[model samples]
Target chain A: MTDLYGVVPEPLAFAARDWGDLAELMERSSSDLGGQGVGALAPSVQAAASAFLTAWAGYAGESAAIARGFSSALDALVADATHTDDAIDTHFGGIDARLGPAR
Target chain B: MTVTIEVPASQPTIRRPEGQPGGSDTLAETLYTAASRYEEFADEADQLLAPRGFSGQGQNAYQAAGGKAAGEHRAMATTVERVARAVTAYADTLRDLLREWQELSDRQDVLDDRRTALIADINATTDATEAQIAALRERASALAADYAELVTDHDGLHRRVRANEDLLRQVFESATSLDEALSADGGVPEFAQQAMDRPGAPGSGATPEETRAWWEDLSEAEREAVVSSYPGLVGSADGLPADARDQANRVLLDDDLATLGSKADDGLITPAEQKVLDNARAAQQAMADADSFEDPITGERPGGQLWLYDPSAFDGDGRVAVAVGDLDTADDVAVFTPGITTEMSDVPGYTDQMQNLYESTRYNGDGSSVATMFWLGYNTPEGAIDWDTMTEGRAADGGERLADAVDGLRASRPDDPAHMTAIGHSYGSTTTSYAAADHDLDVDDVALIGSPGAGPADHASDFSVGQEHVYVGRDSRDFVAVLGDEGWIGKGGLGLGTDPSSEDFDATRFESEREDRGSTRLDGDAHSSYLAHDTESLYNLGLIVDGHGDQVNTASQSYDPWYDVPQDPEWDRDPSSGVPGQSQTRDPGQP
Candidate 1:
């Protein structure tokens, strides 16, 4: 039985666990490829991102209804982070904006 | 949601928000949105923490990946703002202390109780500023911890970001392979791939420390097997430390060919990928070399030298009165700065100025122990000075150049790290005060002689002179010292409240002497008489040089630092100041 006050329900329920698992996968993948290329370095970077996602998801899980809103927003951010180069290069009609000083 | 109101601070019912006005939005949203909108406002601060992609760089990418998670970097930004506010508050506190101190000093007779209270206030203010510094340090430490966690999670994020740049170069190198082999039909490959294959880019390599560890982790049998397999690699491993040798052996013997095959199977071993990996390694090497030095003064690494000077010639020139003295029988070494258009060759002569005064000083009866340096070597521009050209803006180049020179001096004389005093004459005073503020110099006092302008207003908190003790010397007739322009002369220039030369000047109020020349009151040549009224100014000068607090003498005084004399104002006035009927002469006996 999901506790209404503390536990999340169904798909939104595993939001924290899913993010944590993905973060762990990223770290393992990075370590596996440590010598072949920069991929080996990915796990370390992904781990922090994973940890942060997990924490945020856990915070929202207390109120499962709100988890959907936060998780969807997080999913969008992840998509943005992965497609950074393409989003930056596309220039027009891009979602993720480039950060830092102008040329 | 807009509202406006004014509230009295004394009201007890005033409501305040628990947090700042920005609301409890998650850290990620704030950082991401700000970066996305601003896009181009990265200062030195942006790169201060971990170097890599900010969420604003690509909104869609961040959003798709987990925008809120990436946006969490905003917490670090808040930490930085908190630290900055702390420093600003400390500066404001110092400013207040200066205002209060100046008011209390103006009274004709500063009672013992008042002086004691003022000192306590100064101590309290300093303590408060120190507390702010501590708070900033704590915030900075926490931010650093967060950043370290980020670095760990990001794994090779630093290497990868840099690798992307290198991979671009490599892709540009092997055009034939990149154009035909990768795409099959000779369609031009993307610039990103082109960049990866470019030669002369950063290579994939671990840090020396990491390499050392690799060497240490290998077994002897494995190391030998690897050494036999790769001859050149083995020889390179010899000069390396034990740890590096072990790590090198590990890479050679670890039988990592299986992993490489898997990586290739996963399509992760593309030419672009290899190029980026190589680049990351190269960047790591460069970063390691850069962090080796901590001292800003002598820490010239890959860059050009900031400044350099040789003072060996001063020792040989006997004409240069050289005496290295220790202060008050203590170990505190002192450097005495005498001002004016002094050339490098004139450095030795100024040493006599300190030595002569030191001989008469009660602290320096023999003038042997205190190591006093006469810094007349700096090349000062010879011409009438203007405030605009002396300070920031266009004159900032000169200021930077001068700062570099002083830094060079401090670096060269590290052995004698003593409390220093810069005794400036006329324009030299301006330079000394300006340099002190700009550099956060270790000098104890900036004693001005025949000064013309105010001290540096911008660096008051950074200075040790407590803003008010930016000491000034003037005579009533000295026209140049009293000249005012743009309000800088009276307020910022001398750091003195009233003209020291005026007849009504109340020097005794601050427990300081009143002289036709030596007093803070403007008088005499108004421009030139510092070296003439030699004894009084020179004695006070000796006390300051000795690092002693200001001393007041009330009884009739008659003397000279270099020669004994009956107390009189004969030498105080400029010979040219007298009427036509009166005659002036440079007597052989009189100063």
Candidate 2:
């Protein structure tokens, strides 16, 4: 009899890289914003913090949107909806292409 | 001297018959002669040793001579006594042999009598069979006559329908023309004159166009008069073709039905037809009652109770969750799981699918101790990205729900012995395998049909129920099985390779003779027909349901009613022989 509890292999390297990228971004954003007092902080430092916040917010929003979009796309594909390809491209397919390089 | 003299007379020869007591008499005579001869011999020897007056010659010699003479006399007496006892013993032996022979003869007589009676019984049976055959012939003749009458009646009805068609067409033409004529509002008297002058009017019985023209020329009062006069004819014409066809077809069909009914009534095939009719009636009733799952509006399903549930899923409280049959009884329970996209609607047709299994069950004909349930309470995903994770929560919930149902049944029917058989088809098999693995169940048999993914591997103890391992049925024609065996990579197909039908999977295999290709015996249709074949899959399934594992011949084995084993050249190498799939490798690592 074959072993019943076999698990499919996952890409550990890819997963580690994703976590590493997110961790580096979090660290850099925190350090750039943490050192200055609220009133004394230079305009550039303040601007950098704002830019980091905006970028983080946009990335988070896009990540969430992509997950939801992929789910809807999968549902449509199951239901044989015509918009399946577009949904897949904009969500799951487009996500790695848009975010992987940036990360 | 006197004994010697008597012997000299040449005693009449003593003779004994082969089986008479004379043998004892002969022995007695012989013993008497022998005794006398021995006495004479001893007396002569004594004289030789003693020499008449030797005792007087010397004191010691005289004593020795007296002692020898006295010993001779005693020896002679003992010999005579021994011969007499021998004669008596011979007589007893003869008597016992005679008694034994008589007893055997008596037993032989009784056996002969029984043999005679058996011959007579066989003759009687032959006579009865001949009479039955004659009656059957008569009934067949009657059926032929009735069929001929029905055909003639059908022909006559068709002729009437044809004739009616012409009349109906004529009426339709007349009425349609009249209606067209009435379409125009007329200058009463002038129109009436012009309509009357035209030929082929409805009353004139001419062409419909001419009839319309004549009616159009009629005055208003004249048109009304014409309409009123022919209202009945107009109505008849309008309804003619449909009414006539319906009437004719009904008449002919009824005639044929009557002939068939009479054939059944005449005892030609009364019993068989009655059985078929009963089955048809039951099927009809089941079909009718099936759709009647409590009008969601009325909540009218009887015996409002939770008979079925999926542990990890939602249960319909007020609505009908399942259509149940035979489950209310305290007997054997069979739960059927339909793979891939099974819902409550699948329950209705499931009864037909399991007819063979149900028929072979021990309590089949009795209908009291056998119960079957189509367990569609699980919420399996309609589609899946990965086969295993498709109905993740739904499958877990179903397992839990089934556990609860089993528990509840056991508690309520504690006194009655319950045996449960679980049958899964397609994806349903996976769900069942999961349920059994996750929970401790009282299931006796688990059968998977058209399975694609893994089976029960985690719970080593799950299949230990009832000593029989899970049974798997797969046909070569099943297209789902064609998915090469990597245990369904990427998108999971029907869990085909994990089942017993796989060459290395090692379970009892029931290979179907229903061919789907070439000259081979297998129905080509995919995963749909695992239990459909008669001799192969269906027969083995029935055996499983009846718990007759030892009697079953798995895919590699062959059974022939007339011979000890099937003689087909492929019999030995057939799929039942544990031959692994031709295209797939045996991977013991996967379930």
Candidate 3:
């Protein structure tokens, strides 16, 4: 058997959670795309084509908000980690001071 | 437990947590940069994409793409703005925590040093003789004094830093709110109007310090908008900064001059309007020609600065005020109020006197900043001989305005108030005295030149200042001074009251002799010639204005038996009755 290892950071985990929902929405919208060319088309058909492009553009635009949310969540996570590490260091220093120099 | 005990050789070094992606300072910078980029992108997209929608068949496709791109860009901009705000808040919190850590570390180091010194001192004292202990005590006392001084200095620095931080925080908050408001559609006008209402509007009841702080919080563009749109409000409002007022007033003056000049060129002005236009033009010319009018004593160019200008004032006689130096920051300021026939047209003549006084005082002040202002804010009686309107009523009304102007000067330079002197000549003297006596005028000194009276005040003490601060100068040949002495002529008196230069009125009188200046004799026109160059009156006035009262050439108190006495009927009947070869008709009631 081959030995396997992986590391998934908390920020990546948060981004993955939002990426699943966005991917599903994009997949659904992609299936409804009109296959009409922009030559000698009826007004209704042109309107439908324009709407299709606008809808796809909006679905793509949602990624920016997702990225901003992920950034904020990662920032908070890193801050928490730093605080916990400091606490651990302080606790260990106290223990060492109390149980000084094993004879 | 007989276990072996060991102590650490040194204190442990406390290490801060590492691996933080961005430090507080870096994070703040990044957020600000992101915000700026988002704003630029949004602006560019709106400019390029918004107007090109659905123009033609080929353009329609492009327009559609542009519209989609612009919409996405705008949404991304909003998203980024939210992220930047969050990041900035986080950064600020981190910065505060870091500052706390730094302060703690600094305190710990100080404590460690003190502990080490105390231990050494303890060890030395344990084995020391009594004399050594006393010497150590003396050194410790000296150290205590040094520490006290250091603490005082540290407290001052800490307070300054805290104040700076507070100001920075206020500015940052204002900028953030302003940015948000400006990002909204059609928000600029609303924001500007709000700004005008709060701080830009005149008579808003904001204190000078508050107004100054609010002014500081504004951007340069915002300040320009306020000045351009609200010149009348800003130019005359008290409690606004002097430089701001001067800027606004200069703009107003230029615009007025331009408008009047255009009207005159078109020949559309009435006779009265033409006079006003001419006066404004002549004042502008005088300011331009001030380079040639050098001080006779120091030969320095005393360029006149227009402080106040109103071309359509007082039925188009035009009210104006000009200063010689920077009154805003001067150490000493003298404001001269001209009496009869003073108007915008006579500004050059009045400003000439002010410039002479300004230069003389500046030369005598020995590097002290001195400014002299020619104040023609009042509508003086039209004719030189108009005594009816020159009485106390006109002075009373003008007194209020004078008081307000003085108060405005004080308010403008509240941080560094100047030593102000109110000098009034002729009927202007009555106006100044009325302000001092009744209106509670704020001034360091009150000086009257060729004065008829001290308004309603019988003595110098009535002006709410020290008697020594009241200065009076009068040429004996000046006939106006006698008007106040004739009590039987008018209701109460012919003029305001008893002459301030009289011995009984108890004012410090300065010498003002009517003499010739080389070929020119200023004897008959002694009242107007009080400000003549190389005259004792002008020199004394300059000294008094510079707050050098001890250096003034004081006039000796010569007793006049007829002082304050009613004019005898015999003397009034014929001018030659008192002395031969002096034949002239007497007008006892004439001003």
Candidate 4:
């Protein structure tokens, strides 16, 4: 049976999983071809192609950071619905954060 | 139904785009990959945040901070996805434009071949019936119509690309605003806002010394914030360090290339905007080319610094100044201004020529760092049309700008001012002369090559450099340089002024005759060959720029018969009556 009156663990759990997936994707995409991609395009531009990379890096890093924050909060919300039908005190581990200008 | 604007078919402007940048395909792939991730971000956020989800629950759910925060998060994710889409579209547009250029260019090649064959068919029709000749003529008409339509398509694409760029700019703005709002409310700004209130920050309008002092006082974080936020202002400031300015200007320049360079290849801008684009491209290419330099004296390879970047400065002519070496502290410096029709777009070529001048100066002078700067900080008169419309007005304005530049250079390096030389070629010499005469241009020496006249300062004594330091070079065959003589263009303000190489004017004359003087004025091979390597004029110029003016081999000034008459008048010399080319060394190396 589904309870429509309050917060539940089913969706929170799903949200946490999906948010973790987003973080994983962001990190993987950034780590794999971020530098090589920007480097290949750098010489064609000639001067200061680093700024374009910086803009991309900031967006990726910041979005990943925001997603982690929400995921952690959702887990805490699941724990707060103690007496409800969906009560699961869970703590998803954080993703390793890397913050630097994309090389 | 589509409305088509009739593009003038007379121009027949179809050519392959040259210098296509490498590695765009890799970037487009990267953008596609990134866009997919962003889409995932938005899609996942939407599914979990639906009405049946935790945030969209009971009556109290609307009052919950968690629910509200979740809404904001969802909004940001969607907005970011749009940013990703916009960037991806931008990348795709670039590739598509390149394809369009190439395909149309190939079509032109085919059309050209058909036209050639049609001509042969018409010629071979001499032995055929009236029907055969009619068929050949129809073929010619078909080919002509094909070419006209192709030109129209080329013109239409430029406008369409500009429209795409305009949309991309708006998307970027929306994303930036959304990010700033979310991030600012979530946490404190990264750097203190109070630190930016001082001078030398963008729009401070402070003097170079004050700007430098203020910049030196800023913290590392504050400096970074300023550079990232207001790159154009920071990059163009004279007081900032060379490397810092270079880094900032490169970012600004790259932005210009990405946003505005697409429609520039086929000349698809308004007259006012065209100047701005030309100047930006000039600065862009100069820095791009400077990436290849490794100083012969010192192994340092520094990118060019954009000292002045005022696009649309001279009634839409634009202005830009680029420095190849460290101008702050050097043993020698030369600020070169080019002649008629020259603009920032031509400065990269001049930058290369100036590099040669630097090499010769370094070889002859005492071992020290030498810097050469290319200054196109004026609206140069453009050939006969501009000459007729407003000739002296532009040069006079250029003179004022040149004076201010030298003043700023001095102010920026008060303690260790380098030995500076002012060099002007052809009409630029008149511009330089007005700087010295009217604005009191401060320099150690002045060099005028192929000068028609020296403006108001006809006598060398009228200049700040004094007669001993003023040098002149004239190829006798360069008829344009003869415009300064009173008899050629006739009296007071009608022409430029007295020829700097005339005996009466008394400036040190240098040998500038080239092996090949073109038969006509349009063939200006000798007129513009003063800067060529291994030439006497270039070596003499190097000596003057290096402060070894006494060492240059002098040539006799042209004699004027006006002095022979007791009651002297502006004398005329026949243009055809000049000595044939003299072999000073008969191709022997000057060095």
Candidate 5:
């Protein structure tokens, strides 16, 4: 138990940070593409392309929201574990005082 | 990590996780195994360390040091084991949370996939795009709602685990404190005093279970001290076990009798004091007589035990209770309350009735032990025949006391509780009914014999035990039974409520028939003949006290039919019309 203390696993944090970075990159890439080659398409085809981009943006936004939620949950879990560890330490200290020096 | 991605012309393929780590089954099984291991360690530690804490038969310095060392080790081991158990529980909670989180994540994935498909369909067709987008929005909203519920559930589990850990810590601390106190010389008394002075005192809203637990935790010497010093507190407290109350009350009774008897023997006392002393002596004599009194039915002398006695109670009217057998261990017990005109002086007669009922019940019980108590624990009315004496005021006061007595009995016998019944005779019935109605008295069955009415209740169903367990017995010719219904002519009727034996009251009517038996005109003897030997009333009462409800002979005939009638017409006739004026006085002489 003592060995596991203060070890907050960063897998969820890493995933959330990576997902946010990817979403930003995607938005930049889409903006650049819209400014260049996609500008030359027929009106109907351009309209369809714009609709697909909008759908992709929505999916990216939702993914970013989910990643944030997971990051917050992980933070809360770490806080809980820290509190439990402190409580266990205080309890053990009191027990030591009552029982005198451990053999 | 940044990626250059290509937008699909139609729809992007949805990705699913190849494998999920730490499934619910694996996590739960691991937690269970840890918990089991901790429990096993606790058991083993207790076995190893508990015996060491006990000092061997030597009081030398070396032995003392060894004992102190052992005690410390024991305490440390116990604390470690308890902490381990708490950790196990916390781990189990975490396991549960992990399982729930996994399920929630799976649900979120499914919802995400649905939203993605809906969004793709929206981009595919212009006509259906609005509906598809709306469907996608609904799925997203559902996912948010599910996430909120999952968070709430997780928070609740977290709170529970924290609360459990706090409780474990508190228990461990309490045990340590108790051990330290025990090690100190003359600390037990101080500890007991502190416990007694704690938030919930003996009679102040502490439940019987709480009282029993507190009592069990005390050492024998501490228990004795509490009983001796605070007999009244222990004796009358609602939650204390019955045996403890009995012990405390018996100690008080003996001390009281000795003091009162010594005062009387000194030969200098007021009339009032004399009466109290006399009542105390009478109670003692009754107890002694009960010891010698042979059971006519069983032919075995079961003797008696005094559960309660207060000579100075009721402003010298005195209160006394004598059980014909050991009530603490009895399988079945009945507490009979005597009504009007009962006093400590009547203990002999009451105890005789109790003894008879006890024997009858024991004989009918098929080897089951039965204890019957003659509880004269109130100042009954001074006059037996006065209508004013039948008021509900006395019954109400007596009812509260009766309720306490029942609670005391319940406390005394927490384990293997007796099947208890309350038998109230005459005004006692009114008192018992008041107890049943107003005080919520804890009794299994209630029998109202020769009762005028049940106080405050027009029907037996109005009582706490309901009509099913309410037994009524009244001889048809008993004149006292009518007084409950007949209001005071000018002041209004007796307000004791409805007669329990009346059909409208709807109680189980048992036989109280008092017919002639040989030379005895038992039937002619009304009101008090219900307890006569060999009477049907006593037989049925015995059956009820023994919990043989089906065997009780219920009265087939109704007593109310004959009692409910108009005033006689003869009393309303004109005073001047003697024999109808002799038909104008002509008869034989004029002819």
Candidate 6:
């Protein structure tokens, strides 16, 4: 909570990566379930199944969007950290160059 | 005017998919895993975010992201969990129906037996009364009624099974329709659409790194949408992600199979189309084999990717490349090209060997990433004994394609490059050697096993990677390995090239087994055992692919005899004649 050590980014990054991977899996599973022909079911039954599945897919899609949002947010966090670090390094590098092997 | 209907003698059986039919991915377990992943992923994301773990803008952003993600993930988990439950229910019903069917079928058998017995008894009773005969007729009618009832029940159960499946199908279909709507509303990324329409931005002229970066930038849904829409192009496109290609190619393979099968069924298939169908079937089998493969060494299922698939390439012989691991991220990658008589059907067998090689490399390395590809991307010689085998034309053409594949791999992930190894077996070795020599094959190492000859390459020095990085493996008993021998005369690299494993060629020679494991060397068993599991040759290949070629157990150089006379091995021969300075050969049989 205090963020003294600033250790949130690593876990955050991991979560983002996992979320991204999970989203892909969800999408593939959703597609497969929807597209694959369930040969055992009757046409009428299949139609009924479709209506039920569409509602589920909609929910899944919403969930996927949320996961993606989390991933993107974490990506931004990482990118910011990198940018801040790069800026600091650039400033220090200039100083070091000006110092010219003195310190 | 009443209509009369008679009771049928036996019940008609209904057929359905049993116990996870082939190519059907309706396993409840899959959805269960999705749900599980969501739970885990959500927990991890929420662990920090709920407490505002970050500082400044990042913290605020994460806090905002977490609230909705956590809720959605929870909802997704629940959704998939319910879906899984529904699937389980359907499966249970299916199993129950099967048992019910069996029971009814068994009853029919029993009824037939009873009917036969009753007939026999009536025939034997010569002095039976009219009353007894009438009673027997009633009993027979009762049996018929019972059979009629069973038939009705059987039909009812069949309908019940359908009804049950329909319920589950409805759930699936509902999700499908929603997904379709989502996709319809800008699911297909405009960049992908552009790529399909005109080969620009990451594919046509862009480097593989460019392609990968562009691909990685897209959202998961967008990626799926794009792949689903243009499976044919994306499936075969070079420099893309291996898994994505695998997915697209599988879909493409199925579509091709279905389309071609339909045409042939209607008697509208042409000869060329028939060939395409056969090749597609072969590719499908390869994918299935990859799917079912259990790595013997690792006990891991490193399933295959149809990295490249063309059902009708090379004059209907077909061309295909299968990768056993993730090519986009592997630290070590080997592109193995096979030699004479290789075709689409040969892919399944080759992919297994590639996996073996992949495992061997990983075993030898420090547990880094490795992907091995079984590449049959050339028009190979049709027969070993044919006049075509004695020419460099096929190898020359194959060499260029081999170079492109290697280059594509290099370009795909230029930021962190894989230690690429190009391997050719039998005539494939010759083709690989030519690729290295002529096409400037971009790889860190080149390994040739049981090579007939290096097309146009007289020595390892001809390769751009330098003579030191070249490796050769030929079992002494492998007769085909000697076909590359440039007998006392300078002929050429392919048909007339020097033996890669010989002292004169001066490549890094490793001991591959010469044990007569095969019934005869002429059958090519000896020639084909280079990548066999747990063997020295395979071990050396692993070491080389792992970038530890110096640690390989080197074998004594075996040279072509001077006009059929047996020559001394590398130990007895004057080693100063051909040994290069950079190659540090391991002691014979040394690890």
Best-fitting candidate, measured by lDDT? 6
What lDDT score is found at residue B433 in candidate 1?
52
- Candidate 3: give the clashing pairs: none
What docking grade applies to model 4?
incorrect
**Model 4 lDDT at residue B291:** 61
A69-102 in candidate 4: lDDT tens per residue? Answer: 7677666666655444333312222433467764
B107-191 per-residue lDDT for model 2 (tens digits): 4444445445444444444435556555544544444454444445444433433332222222222222222212232111233
lDDT agreement of model 4 with the native: 0.62
Question: How much does each candidate deviate from the true structure in C-alpha RMSD?
Answer: 31.3, 55.4, 28.3, 24.7, 32.3, 23.7
User: What's model 5's lDDT at B456?
Assistant: 82
TM-score of each: 0.29, 0.34, 0.52, 0.55, 0.50, 0.55
Q: DockQ (C-alpha) of model 1?
A: 0.01
Choose 1 or 3, whichever is better by lDDT: 3
TM-score, first chain, each model: 0.27, 0.34, 0.44, 0.61, 0.60, 0.66
Q: In model 1, state the lDDT of residue B262.
A: 30
lDDT of 3 by residue, A1-103 (tens): 1111122244334433433433343333233222213222222223432443344334334434533443344345445545666687788777744444762
Q: lDDT tens digits, residues B1-591, model 5?
A: 222212222211222221122231232222222222222222322332222211234214323433443344334333322222322322333344456556656655665675567556545645445565566556556656655565565555445434433332332233233343123221123444566765445765777566766777765545544554455677666566545555555545544443334334433245776787688678778878777866544567766776676777878888778888777788888999998888888898888788768756755565788889998877788776565465567888889889878887887677778888999998899999989989988888999898867888877778777778989776666666655552223114553677676666778877665544222223456678677555667777888898886667676424333445522111222211112111111112221
DockQ of 3: 0.01
- State the TM-score, rounded to 2 decimals, of chain A in model 3: 0.44
Model 6 residue B357 distance off true place after TM-score fit, in angstroms: 1.8
Candidate 2's C-alpha runs over 4 A off are A1-103, B1-306, B309-325, B328-330, B360-368, B384-393, B456-467, B481-497, B513-523, B533-535, B556-591
* Model 6 CA deviation exceeding 4 Å by range: A1-103, B1-192, B195-210, B216-219, B265-268, B295-298, B385-388, B490-494, B517-524, B560-591
Candidate 6 CAPRI-style tier: incorrect
Better of 2 and 3 by lDDT: 3
